[model samples]
Target chain A: MKTQSILLKQRPEKTPQNSDFEFKEEEVSTPKSNEVLLKSIYISVDPYLRGRMRDVESYIEPFQLNEPITSAIIAKVEKSEHENFKEGDYVLGHLAWKEYQVAKGENLRKVDPKQANLSAYLGILGMTGLTAYFGLTEIGAPKEGETVLVSGAAGAVGSTVGQIAKIYGCKTIGIAGSDEKIDLIKGKFNYDEGINYKTTDNMKEAISKAATNGIDVYYDNVGGEILDATLQNINRNGRVINCGAISQYNKDETATGPRVEGILIKKSVKMQGFTLQNDFGEKFNEGTKKLAQWLQEGKLNYEETIREGFEKVPQAFIDLFSGENKGKMVVKVAEE
Target chain B: MKTQSILLKQRPEKTPQNSDFEFKEEEVSTPKSNEVLLKSIYISVDPYLRGRMRDVESYIEPFQLNEPITSAIIAKVEKSEHENFKEGDYVLGHLAWKEYQVAKGENLRKVDPKQANLSAYLGILGMTGLTAYFGLTEIGAPKEGETVLVSGAAGAVGSTVGQIAKIYGCKTIGIAGSDEKIDLIKGKFNYDEGINYKTTDNMKEAISKAATNGIDVYYDNVGGEILDATLQNINRNGRVINCGAISQYNKDETATGPRVEGILIKKSVKMQGFTLQNDFGEKFNEGTKKLAQWLQEGKLNYEETIREGFEKVPQAFIDLFSGENKGKMVVKVAEE
Candidate 1:
């Protein structure tokens, strides 16, 4: 079978350009014993993928040049030689940007299409969901009546964080780029208040107004001035769960530093940076199970700003840095 | 009876001068019911007193000009009007920079002179002891085999911190100003290592050598470049207990901010600042009791740099900013 793949042509300097990636064709092989051949149905395009593009020491290894970029994907097993999986079974696995993949059965898990939308496996029911769940409950540790302020709240992880804070009976406030995204956060995602940071002249005042009491938990997705503004209003003994710093990821040295660290002294705040890869031990199953239950009960909602075709995977990944996605951005490689 | 008191004549711009204080004599009033008149034996001069001299919002209120300044003091009840206190009883209470004080009977607790020296009541068994105890056990959260680094390690609080860390089976490293103080930390206090920061050209390299395993708990008494250096060398998930920032207290607006805050994200560190007056409500009594027990058991030793006469209190307090004293700095107001 002929499979389409996106390859990194050059390392990105700041914001990634389309010229940085090259679309190529690769031949797919048949499944070996204990392996499965999958047709990629959906591909996840996340901000963390940007880190993988750089040749730096991070939680995960960087993607090598000229190799098909791999990420979390929801797919259908077209052929299986493993005892546990069969042909036509839907599954979720970390797979490359291609129309087809020959993966080991152990790396893929079967998902039921009837239980939830198959695309949900690429977002709220998958890695994105797990990141939001553990980051909020374990790290942020929001209490009842506490105020939670999430940066990049219109994005996948941030949107879920606000909703989960609401589930915990917390006052949820979101900071997003556009008015449309802000509306979606306040109206669709059930955030109590939403601020369009681009239009706000005084971020500290806006945060104060949104968090009338004071910020008790800060789910930080975008670092820099937004993180600085949140620091000013953090209550004593507040927790800052740093899931990602999308704002600083693409910038040069000048845009990297945050200025409001003095508040750490005033508030006695705890700011912790973490990746989901750290939680891949024995406790992961327990966290994923709780997230699955929440999704089943209709207590959690997620949106996917998906682009059609496997060729668009690189562009979709770049869109994350541009804040173009309303929620989790995904690429549809093939029809279900 | 006549009582002599030292009053704050004027607030200083930078370093406090002798002219900042004025000595005056007043008639001692008779104690009312449940009140005891105390003749001060020792008055503690701490770094936090500098904050009181400045008209800024802090954990405690600023001292008013032309009024007697007060701090924790060890005194003997010269006369009593209440059943709880007797004329010969020794106690520790917040008494002014005066030769005598009339305090409520409940405001004093009888100190057993047989268990430890009476001067220890101003340091190892008093607020300084409690500050070290709670800040280490509660905030630093030292674990066995961990490397504990303490700044201002020759001072009252820092000396106690190094000793307690050693008791907890942690490798203790002390940073002090002079070679004599550093020698005392290693010889008398039994710290694992000592570094004279003034003589070291590269603080980060010095800290790296002293804390070979990387610092897990940093008891930050001096917070400027030392803190910046410690931040760079901290281990993953390290805890920094900000007891005091003696380095920046006297500086004007031109003082440089910490340049290593990015390490907080790199190491996922937790830095918390606290005043013993704020977080040590229930823990204060518990810590002091433990410290007193340790002193009685000969497991903890203390030192005092005493300046003679009640008129020397202001100078002793001012000397704290200049790092003149070796251990607990105290003004000997009267012979017990």
Candidate 2:
């Protein structure tokens, strides 16, 4: 069989360009014993992936030179030599941005299409939902009548975080780059207020107005100036969940912003950062159950900006930096 | 009675100047019914007081323009109407920077001079000790065999933190401004290694050599470039206890450094800040008991930089900014 995969050709200085990715086709052998052949259906594109491309050490290992980039992918089991997975069974696994992947059955988790949409396994019903759940509830634990300020509020994690905060009876305030995202968050995510960062002259003032009682929980998906502004408006004992820093992901220059320790000392804020894979390893099952139940009961909703075909995976990942996607950015590899 | 007090003559822009405080002698009335007359013996001068001097909101309320600056003071009870306190009893209270203060008996905590040295009540056996205990054990949570890096290692809280981490079986590394402090921390605090940040051209290299296992717990008392350097050497799942940012206390410019969120996300570090008065209010008894037990067992030792006379209180406070004091900076207002 032949598999088409995307490879990291060059480490881009700033925002990833099209030339940074190289598409390659290779022949693959059949799955051996205890291994399953995965046909990628939906490939998740996330901001955290940018960290892996930098050849620097992080929570997740950096992508190796000339190796296919891998992430959460909803796939169909084409063939299996293991009892755990059978042909045509839908599963989710950390597979490459390719059409076919030969993975061990132990690494692939069976996904029930009847429980939810298949692509949802790569999004809200999967790691993205879990990230939002743990980061907000466990780290940014908002109380009833407290205010939650979410940066990059239209992104996958931020949108879910705002909704979760709202469910906890917190006043949700979102900050996003576009007016369209502001509207999406306010209308769909039950956010009480939304600040369009692109139009706002003063983010600190906007945050102050939105979070009148002060921000009790700050779900930080975007860092840099927005984070600096959020630090100014935090209440005493505020929780800052540092889930992502998409704003600085592509910056070539040294990352510089307002010193955090001083403000943290002044306000007694708790700022913690984590990647979903490590921090919530054992809690994924619990998180998945809660998120799935929320979706079933109509308390949760998600959006995806999916690009068609395997070749567009790089573009989908690059578009994340430009704020072109509304919610979870995914690339569809093959027909289910 | 004539009471000599130090008043805040001007709010300092950066480092507090001696001229910012004015000494005045005023007539104070005797205690009526439940009030007690206190003669100050040992007065605490802390870096956090510099924050209170600024007319800005913080964990503690800012000092008023022309009010007598107050902090943890160990005093002698000269006269009392309440049955809880007696003449010649040693007490600790949040009293003004004055030689004599007529305060309500309810605000005073009776300190037994027989249990520990009288001056210890103003330091290791009091608020400074609690700050180190809670900030280290509660927030830092140094595990056995972990590398604990402490900034401002010769100061009140930092020296205590290094010693506590040592007691927990962790490898302790201290960073300070002077070779004298480096020697003090290494020899007295039982630190495995010491880095003179003033002499080291490359802090990152120095930290890497000292913390060969990588930093697990960072007790940050002096934040800024030191914090920026520490961020580079933190291991996975590191805990950063934001005790104080003394380095930035006198900065007139807006404090800026390497953005922390990215590094935090990459390493999964948790940075939390707190004031002893608020976060550990109820836990003080628990901390005090443990600390007192340690001291009695001869497992804990402390250093004090005492300046005698009520007239030297302002200079004592100003000296804190210059890092002239090695440990707890206290002003002795009168004889024991």
Candidate 3:
């Protein structure tokens, strides 16, 4: 059978361009022992993948030049030579950006289509949802009556973070790039208020206004001047969870902003950063179960900006920088 | 009897000046029912007190203009009406900048001058010592064989932090303003290596060279270019304890440097700040006991830069900003 894959043609200097990715056609190889052949169904395109394009040290390894780039993908098993997985099984794995590939069955987790759609596993039930869950609960640790502020408010993780914070009995405020996103977060995500960063001239004043009691917990996704502003208005003993830095992901030079040590010392604040697999590997099952329960009980809601086609993976990933997508951005490679 | 006191005459714009303080002479007040008359023996001049001079909200109250400024002081009970304290008893309390003053006996903690020097309570056995102990243990959490880096290495808290890190069996590196300070830290504080930030052209390179295995824990007392350099060289899951920001304490405007959210997110580092009384009120006895035991066991050594005479109090404080003191900067108000 024929297969299609995306390779890192050139490492991105700043924002990713279509030319940085190479599309290739190849023959699909049969599965070896304890391996299963997977056909990509829903391919996740995330802001964090931008970091893998650079040749620098990070929590996760960087993507080597001319190699296939990989991320969280929902795939259907076409052929299985393993005891744990059988034909027609839907599995989730950190697989390559390919239409068909063979992977060890141990690397995949089975997902049920009857409980939720196949695409939900790539969004609300996968790493995106788990990322929001653990980062807010473990690090943010918001108490009742406290105020929680979230950046990238309309994105997948940020939207989920605001909902969870509200469920945990805290007031929620969000910061986004567009007025439309502001409305989406406030109206649909149960956020009490929202700030449009593109229109606001003074973020510190804006944050102070929205967070009347001061922000006790801040879930930061877009890092830069907005982070500085949030730090300025943070209440005493505030917590900041650095889930992602989408705004700085595309910068060529090291971004400069106001120093935070003074503010942290003054307010006795805690600022922490994390990745899901590295920090929460032991609690992943617990996180996934809780998130699934929230969805089933109608306590959770999610949005997906789907780009259909094998050729649109790079474009979908690049659109994250421009804030073109509303929530989780994914590409639909093929029908089941 | 006559006594002298200092008042905060003006809010300083940058570095504090002698004119910012006013000296006044008056008669010492007699003790009331439960009050005791204290004759100041030693006073602690710390970098954090600079924050109090500003008319801004902080962990502690801002100093009132034309009012007596207060700090940690070792005093002898000259007269007492309370049953707990008597004449000649040495007590440690956050007291006003007065040679002789009356205070409620309940606010002071008795310090045995026979166990250690009366002046030792103002340095290694008081807030300065406790700050290093808790900040390093609670936040830094340096493991054995890990590399620990400390800024403001020659100051009271930094020197103590290096000594404690050494006792914890960690590789320690010190960053100070001069080669003399570097020598003091390396020889007396048991620091494995030192970096003269003043002479070093590239601090990131300097840190990378000294900490060949990468800095696992960074105890930050001076926040600025040095902090940014330290963050850049931090290892994965590194810890940063924001004990002080002496470099930024005197700034008129908010300091700006390279944004750290990128490094923190990529490395999943933790950065936190704290004040002793507010964060660790219940742990005071525990920290003090451990610090005292270390001193008694010969595992801890302290240096005091004492300036005698009540008139030199303001100058001694101003000198802290210029890195004039090698270790704990204490003002000797009167003989014990």
Q: Chain A TM-score per candidate?
A: 0.96, 0.98, 0.98
- Judge candidate 1 at residue B278 and give its lDDT: 63
lDDT of 3 by residue, A144-218 (tens): 999999999899999999999989999999999999999999988989999999999999999999988999999
Residue pairs of candidate 3 with colliding backbone atoms: none
User: How much DockQ does model 2 earn?
Assistant: 0.87
Worst 10 contiguous positions by lDDT, candidate 3 chain A: A250-259
Which one wins by DockQ: 1 or 3?
3
Candidate order (DockQ): 2, 3, 1
Q: DockQ of each model against the real complex?
A: 0.34, 0.87, 0.86
Spell out the clash pairs found in candidate 2. Answer: none
lDDT for each of the candidates?
Answer: 0.84, 0.89, 0.92
**CAPRI verdict on model 2?**
high
Give candidate 2 misplaced runs (Cα > 4 Å). none
* Cα distance off (Å), candidate 2, residue A130: 0.3
* Residue lDDT tens for model 1, A244-334: 8787778653443332334455456677666576643456788778878877787787877979987787788887887988898888878
